[model samples]
Target: MALEHAILVSLLEQPGSGYELARRFERSIGRFWTATHQQIYRVLKRMEADGWVVGRDVGQDGRPDKRSYEVSAAGRETLTEWLREPVQPEAVRHDLAVKIRGAAFDDAAGRARLVDEVRRYRAGHEETLARYLAGERRDFPAGGDLDTGQRLQHVVLRGGIAYERMLLDWLDDVLETLLKGLP
Candidate 1:
């Protein structure tokens, strides 16, 4: 999906200024889709110009006035139309997989470097999994009922959690092979 769609969904969840939207993306939406603040600001401008979103300046104390944006009727229509379209499968682009394959031709020192890189990558995935688990606990707390939107969001977060777990498991296999047959 395009960043525009992600922004629309975010604004639909809660109207907010660009800064606030960026913060939300960093905290939650960034788990699936990522965008820099500058990119968000630029898109907000275009979306406003396209009449997909409306922005209003809000007064602030000790700070410049901020323009808060909310999805316009056209934006909702666009999102609805986009949602009905078929989703194509995404292509995998895994650099670590390439590195692991390339290690087959490397010297002992080079293979060791590959192992170190894999360990570093595994560490990052472990941290992400921890964060996902923490977020699930903080957000869901109980297995109680959730609204449709919340349920869907929770499912998506669960997918991320499962993906991280799978990656970690696969990395362990890779690590074992790498260490066992070290050059």
Candidate 2:
């Protein structure tokens, strides 16, 4: 359901073919919302059928015809309704956290591995947050009035940064606990 709205929002930003939409998803919202090319294409078709978007055949010189999708008035109304609604909090689901909770059942070496994995995940998340911050700084700057789409992106990036910082702090606490127990 959120994916459908995401597709509509992407089309509202600008008209694009399914392939282009997939690429934009990877570059922009992939930090939080992930969708495969096939999934994006499928959602686009459904959106077109539902009258949320209209696709036009775009022919390029010496290239296959591509269908570019744009948001309709209906889509704008639907998106506005969605924006006005209360947002639901996402459920937390971390497989590593689950594994770490069960680390007592593992050997010493296994526990060490879990700690290492946690550290690696923290580093990767930090990198991702850095990228988001860089993109936001480049695009929106500090005191600029952003469009609806840019505002959404900014909110997502802020969330990413907060999440990463929390994870890093948690990792430090865990590592300290583990080190204290070492012989």
Candidate 3:
């Protein structure tokens, strides 16, 4: 999906300034779709020019005015049309998986290097899993009432948590197998 679609979904959830939207991407939307602050601002401008989004300048007491954006009717229609399109299964592109297979031709030292790399990769996933869990706790606390949008967001976060966990488990297996081959 294009970055425009992601931005549209986010704005539909809540209208906000470009800075606020970038922060939201860092906190939440970045999990699935990532975009830089520049990208967000650039897209907002294009979306505004296309009549897909409307922006208004809001003046702050101390700071310069910031333009807040909300989806226009055309944007809503675009999003709906995109949603109705059939989704294709995502293609998997795993460099580590390829490296693991190629390691079969390497000597013990090369395999050891791969083992180290696997450990580092696994550590990254472990950190991500921990972060996802912490976010779930903070955002969807037990016994707390959630609005419809929040509930939907929580479910998506849960999916991300599950994905991270699955990656961690698989990485563990990869590390274990690699360790067996090392001296």
Best by TM-score: 1
Q: How close is candidate 2 to the true structure, as a TM-score?
A: 0.85
Per-residue lDDT, model 2, residue 48, is 88
Please give the lDDT score at residue 145 for candidate 3: 100
Query: How many backbone clashes are present in model 2?
Result: 0
Tens-digit lDDT string for candidate 2 (1-183): 689888887777778999998898888767667899999888888888999999999999998889998999998898999989999897677787788778878878888887788788878878877887788789889899888868877887788778778877888898777655554
- The residue-by-residue lDDT of candidate 1 on 27-128, one tens digit each, is 889977888899999999999999999999999999999999999999999999999989868667889999889998988889888889999999999999
Runs off by more than 4 Å, candidate 3: 61-65
TM-score of 1: 0.93
- Who is ahead in TM-score, 1 or 2? 1
Per-prediction backbone clash count: 0, 0, 0
Q: Name the runs in model 2 displaced over 4 angstroms.
A: 61-65, 143-152
Tell me the tens digit of each residue's lDDT in model 3 across 107-170. 9999999998989998988888889899889889999999999999999999999899888889
> In model 2, what lDDT does residue 122 have?
78
Cα error of candidate 1 at position 67, Å: 1.5
